[model samples]
Target: TSEDSEPWHIYTDLGYYSVELIAESQNCGADTLLIDSIIHVLNPSFISTIGNQDISIFPNPVKDKLYINFNKNLNNPMLLNIYDLNGKIIAQKDILSVAPGILELTFNRNKTQKGTYILRIQNTEETIFETKFILN
Candidate 1:
């Protein structure tokens, strides 16, 4: 019940299942419950990976566009900031929208010097990932 303001049980067609509850000071007296009593459920798996740890940059010695892929959903309106080796912001773009899949970023290396640069990807709150690349 909402008296405890916590999810206690999930109910399914077959039976009732209990869920872990986070006790709040206001819920000390009232017990929250979730009941699951359904049956004939299929086992489903949903995989989601976070952070930029698993991201890859192809054609490291990039000449043109850079491709980025993630296994998880990224924040809407992601921010891409490119900085030179001297820590100067060379380019910046706001990714208005992103799907839960692969993303491609095109950079005109012709304007950038043939050296190392830092690419920073920031979501709404924090920096999701960062990488360095060279243009040859």
Candidate 2:
């Protein structure tokens, strides 16, 4: 039999048995018995920290294509600006109409040195969100 909090015993018809105990407390009950198995409930909200902005980037150490997802529709034109660590603007693009969804941007890694760079996204009003990536 399986249980969330241990102290499990397995017995055979031949009179042989083995026991195992997990030194933890179960919130359900201390003396709860499991003839077969027990199921444990999980709270999903405790699994991850979901934020407000809800923007994400993938393939962090990106070589070419970088994708972004925005949680909400943007009122102003979104601006993407890429910069090297030295504060020099390498590339800039003004996205005219961005629906609330995922977007893709491609970078030529061949033109970029293998190092860390910063990607900044802003709106017409200059509210900015920044993320860092490495070229390898």
Candidate 3:
């Protein structure tokens, strides 16, 4: 039920399930909180992949500009989103047009606090890739 001091992850078969979290104070009779949510799990096969697109992001400990490169012949537009460790979106871009070899994008870094962040690339329908990076 527990791993390292990090977040707890629960993986289950495809189904609708309700999960609850209980937090209690040190005092046995102290205040407690109950947090709950409904979780829906879809079959992995349904979301494994629709099309293949190779992606790469560089200058990980980026100073100003974070560059992203993609490899594939994509006709439809793709969206790139960057999020801070707290899951807040910090930057986003839509690749409106490109030829059939590779596409590249750059996000300007300004006043962004130094920390870890997540990079996600997706289409309107599904998320294709996600990775982590650092800002310095």
Candidate 4:
């Protein structure tokens, strides 16, 4: 429940949602109102050349920094994006290349909040990799 008139978040699976509001009074009877399919939660997905299991990032629940570890060598510059639950890009970074072995790509953390986030690594053509992580 919310105290003010501002909006709130309801963490759930990807699907359409409807809101229902009920008002009750001691003197008067109860009234109900519902708006169907107002909110839509979509899965952030994209077609890419690489598979999801091909890359891995350590410390799933990261705190200060995020380390992206992978074995594949990439010559193209990778575009890193950090997205919030609402599919908003909270932070991003551009890397020149990824050498074989463990590598870390750090970005600004001032806007990161405690919630599930999506880390998307892409190239100039299309999205290469995408996964979800938690921020503490």
Candidate 5:
């Protein structure tokens, strides 16, 4: 594709991607010319509405446990909940005192079916962060 070409719309999972563009010619002395580009797709399910810019999660297609990291803490009881696709609550937990650091939690995959689910992190009054995850 050339610079005047329109942008391509592609839907993909969270991961690193590398793309290459090549131009081939038969009459010219050169056989081909190539250029490369890279991109990273972050999980869109992870969103924070409380202005918490340091929240992040890893291992989108988690097998057992997902790692969540927050550079700053909300200083409140963080309510963590997992819900199925039908809006049914599958698991929930309440952390009374969350330190201004990383937190590790385990996910039991045996209780729920293998599919996409929603993970919500919030307080008693409002939601702070919400993201989607897949259980295998």
Candidate 6:
């Protein structure tokens, strides 16, 4: 309608998005416009604290397995844990220092429910990274 001069939209997932808008006029006919990668949506989860800037995760709203990637090679063994917002440990794994510095682990679907989770990656000394993510 004419009230849609300014419209709002919501994206349910994290990825690059393209938007297409078509305008019609009685005398001017119709015109179409498309914008590629117009809206880039990221994980809506809130990260509490991050000690390291080199760590990252993909495919947020993770299902079965969560992939963790380190931008640099690791020098120490790492401990990865997933916890609820209330600080309950849901899953934990010991990730030894490897050649590629990339770690992968599976989350049991029958164990944890869908919600926001905090991922804590640590070494023997201290916590290296902690970020919140959504689980599907």
For each of the candidates, the C-alpha root-mean-square deviation to the true structure, in angstroms, is: 18.2, 17.5, 7.7, 5.5, 11.3, 11.1
lDDT of 1 by residue, 3-98 (tens): 443322223234333444434576466554554543333321121223577565666767777777666655478888888756899888888766
User: TM per model?
Assistant: 0.54, 0.56, 0.53, 0.60, 0.58, 0.60
- After superposing candidate 4 on the true structure, give the runs of residues whose Cα lies further than 4 Å from its correct spot: 1-52, 105-110
In model 6, what lDDT does residue 134 have?
74
Q: What tens-digit string does per-residue lDDT give for candidate 4 at 1-94? A: 5544554554547788888877778999899899999977785333222444657887866777778777777889988888876779888789
User: Residue 64 lDDT in model 2?
Assistant: 83
Instruction: Summarize candidate 6's per-residue lDDT along 1-136 as a digit string, tens digits.
Output: 2336665443557899898888989999999899999887785344455888888886686987888878887779989898986789998888777455567877778887777789999999999998877777
**Reference-based lDDT, each prediction:** 0.63, 0.63, 0.62, 0.73, 0.68, 0.78
Q: lDDT tens digits, residues 1-136, model 5?
A: 4543443423356776666554455776444433443666774334323435677777777787777788775678888888875789988888886656777767765666666778788877878787777665
Question: Any runs in candidate 3 off by more than 4 Å, and if so which?
Answer: 1-53, 100-110
Worst 10 residues of 2 by lDDT: 40-49
Query: Where does model 2 exceed 4 Å of error?
Result: 1-52
Q: By the lDDT metric, which is better: model 4 or model 6?
A: 6
What is candidate 2's lDDT per residue for 38-117, written digit by digit as tens? 32223211112123266777777777877888777666777888887679998898887667788888877677766666
- Mind giving the per-residue lDDT tens digits that candidate 3 earns over 10-105? 343677666544445567754534444476667311212233446666766676667666565566777878887568998888876445454444
Candidate 2 — which pairs collide?
A: none
Q: What's the lDDT for residue 32 in model 5?
A: 49
